[model samples]
Target: MLGTATDAYQPVERRLGITRRIVEVLAETGHPFSVVTKSAGIERELDLIAPMAAQGLVSVYLSVTTLDNELARILEPRAAAPARRLRAIRALAEAGVPVGVSVSPIIPFINEPELERIVEAAVAAGASSAFSIPLRLPWEVNPLFQDWLQRHFPDRAERVMARLRDMRGGQDNDARFGTRMTGEGVWAELLRARLHRVARKHGLRTERRPVELALFQRPSKPSAQGSLF
Candidate 1:
C-alpha cells in the first residue's frame, strides 16, 4: 500500500513499475485476478495509472490505513494529502479509470466510523463496487497494533483486544483458510453483516461481474510471415 507513494520514493515511477510488473504476472495466470492500486492520494495516482488503463481494465483502488494517530500523520500520510479519499475516486472516474474502494484493517472502535464514509464517497465518485476486511493483525501486526492502540486509544484499548480475542476463537487468529481473512465469532458475523448492509444500501455489489472470454480469439497465426529459410 502506498501512503506516501509520491512523497517518499527515490524514483516514484519505478515503484509503480514494480507494482505493475507483479500485476502483469497475475493477469497472465489464467485465473480471475484482482488488482488494488494501494494509494493515498488520487492526484498522484492518476499520473501513475492513466496510461496503464486500457479500454477495459479491471482494477480497484483501496485507500489503506493501519493507525489512528494524528502524530503519525505528520511523520507519514502527510497533512498535505487531504484526508478525502473520494478525491481518488473522482479523478479516476474523470479519466475513465475503472475503480472501486477497499477499506481494510477496519480496527475495532478505531476506524470503524470510516466504513460508511468510505462507502458513501465511493458511490458519489461513480464507483461500481466495494469491499472490506475487518482488521487483520497477523505476524507482528497484532503486537504492533496493540502498541498503537495503547498509545492512541488507551481507555478503550482493553475492550478492543477483548473483542479481537473473541473473534479469533479465543486466539488472536484462527490461522485457517476460510477463517483467516475474516475472524470467527458473534461479533465477526455482525461486522460482516454490517458491511453487507452498508454495501447494499450504497448500491455496491460484492458479486463481481463475470468476464466474457469468448471474444478472445488467438491472433491469426501471423500469416506465417510468408518467410523462406
Candidate 2:
C-alpha cells in the first residue's frame, strides 16, 4: 500500500526506519494493504507484517525484472540482488504471508525473454500470485532509456525501440488507461497472452482478494489539547 510508484524500503530506509514505522502502524490499525518493492530489506519488516497476513490484511509483491544478476545490477544499481529477493519471497511465504512476484517493466528483447522463467522462479520460491507489465517510456524516461540502450546495446537498440513503438502504436507511449500498462497492438496482445499462459501454467493467481472494510478505522489526528469534541 505504501509502496506503489516508488520503493518503500530503499537503502535510505535502513537508516531512517520510516517505512518500518508505516508498516507497524498498518498492522496496529488492521488495515488490509499491499506493498510492492524491489528491496530485500522488506524482510526486516516481516515481524510486523506476518501477523497482519494472518488476518488477510497484508500482501507483498517483490519486483524482479530479470534473473541475470549482471543485467539486474545495470538495470537497478541500488536494488537488492535477485537471489536475495527470491530468499525474501521464500521466507515471507514460509511465515504464512501471501507473496506475489512482480515482473515489471518487461523491457522488450532485453528482459522480456525471461518472463516464463521469472514466473517459474517466483512460484518455486513460494509466491502465490504473479503479475507483469511491459516497459513504458514517458517524457524524460523516454530519452534516458534510449540513451542507455544506445550506450549498452548499440547493435539491437533500434530494433528494441521499434518493437516498443509497435506495441505503443508507433509512439513513445500509450497513455490510455486500459492500454497504458500493457500497451496495444499485435505484440502487446502476444505479450499479455504469454504472461497469462505462464501464470496459469504455474498456478499463480491474478484475482483480487476481497477487502474487509469492517477492519478499517480512520486514524485519529493529533491535536494541541490532545482532546476534541
Candidate 3:
C-alpha cells in the first residue's frame, strides 16, 4: 500500500493470481484448511508489488535463479533487478513487513557456487526465512530446458545432462511424490551436502519466520437493547 507497481510487475502478479483464485475457491467450497502460498514471480520489481496477507498487504519476492549448465548455475547472474529488489526488501523489513527470500529451482549441476551469495544478499535485505525448491520438468520443461542448454552452451551441455541424469535416477525428471522436490541417488546427496554446507556457513535457516497468531477478533454483535427492539 506504500509503493507503486509498474506495468511489467502487474503481469507477474497476475501469474500468482491463479493460485489466489484456487485458494479463494477452495475456502468457499468448505475445504476445511487454510492455504497460504507465497513468494514467487518476476522478482525484479517485487517491492513495487504488494499482495494482501491475513493482516495488511505485503510483498513476497522469490528468486528463481535458473541456469543453463551446472557451472552456469552457480554463477547465474542476479536476475531482473540487483539493487531495486534489495532496496525494496530492506525497506519493507524496516517497515515491519514480513519478507522471505526463495532461491528456487535449485537445479542439479549449476545451483552450487552462488548459494552463499544468495543467502547473504537475502540476509542483508532483511529476509526472515529462506526456502528453496529443486528443479522440475513435468512435460515439455525438460526438453525445453535441455534444448536451451544446447542452444546457449553446447560445450558442456552433455556433461550437464549426465549429472542431471545421475541425480534424476537416469531420467530427466523424477515425478514421484517423495522424490519430486529432490532428485535421487548419489548426485542428489552431493547437491544436498553442498546446500547444507553453504547454508550453515551463512547462518541461513531453512525454516520460515513465525507470524503472529493472536490477531483474530470476531465481528461484534448488536447491543442487547437494539436487538430487542
Where in model 2 is the C-alpha error above 4 Å?
Answer: 218-229
Deviating ranges (above 4 Å) for candidate 3: 1-61, 64-79, 109-111, 209-229
Cα deviation of 31 in candidate 3 (Å)? 14
Count steric clashes of candidate 3.
2
Model 2 residue 10 lDDT score:
78
Cα error, candidate 2, residue 121 (Å): 0.6
Best by lDDT: 2
Q: Candidate 2 on 109-170: residue-level lDDT in tens?
A: 99999998998999999998988888989878999999999988899999999999999989
Candidates in order have lDDT scores of 0.59, 0.87, 0.54
- Misplaced by over 4 Å in model 1 are 1-16, 20-33, 40-55, 64-84, 208-229
Tens digits of per-residue lDDT, candidate 1, 1-229, equal: 2332232222454556555544443334322233454444334545444544542434445543422346337323443232454666677777766677666656777777667766776778767677777666778877977887788789999988888888888887667889877788898888888878888897777654343243333333323552331
Q: lDDT of candidate 3?
A: 0.54
TM-score of each: 0.70, 0.93, 0.62
lDDT score of residue 201 within candidate 3:
68
Residue pairs of candidate 3 with colliding backbone atoms: 70-109, 70-110
Write down the TM-score for model 1: 0.70
